[model samples]
Target: MVASSTSSRSIAVLNTAPTQPSAVETFIGNLLELVIHSIEGVRGRLVGGSPQR
Candidate 1:
């Protein structure tokens, strides 16, 4: 019974460990996208032309 409980707890931990990194990765991805867009907007205004392809 003890072994069974221990294994179950480990399994739960393993399952939850992946979720934190995924959330962090998602947040970083969104932040990078926002930064890229802001940079593009600034570049567009400076060039006074449409954004580059």
Candidate 2:
């Protein structure tokens, strides 16, 4: 019974560990996107005219 309980706990931990990283990755990805967008906006304002073909 002790072994069974320990295995189940380990399994639960393994399942939760992967999800935490996924959430962290998702948060980082969103933060990066926001930074990129803000930089682009600033660049557009500084440049004034649009790019030529």
Provide the TM-score for each candidate, comma-separated.
0.59, 0.58
Off by over 4 Å in 2: 1-16, 49-53
Give the range where candidate 2 is weakest over 10 consecutive residues by summed lDDT. 44-53
Clashing residue pairs for model 2:
none
Best by TM-score: 1
Best by lDDT: 1
lDDT of 1 by residue, 1-53 (tens): 46998778757766879667567668889999889988998899898988754
Backbone clash numbers for all candidates listed: 0, 0
> Mind giving the per-residue lDDT tens digits that candidate 2 earns over 1-53?
47998778757767879667567668889999888887777777789855332
lDDT of 1: 0.80
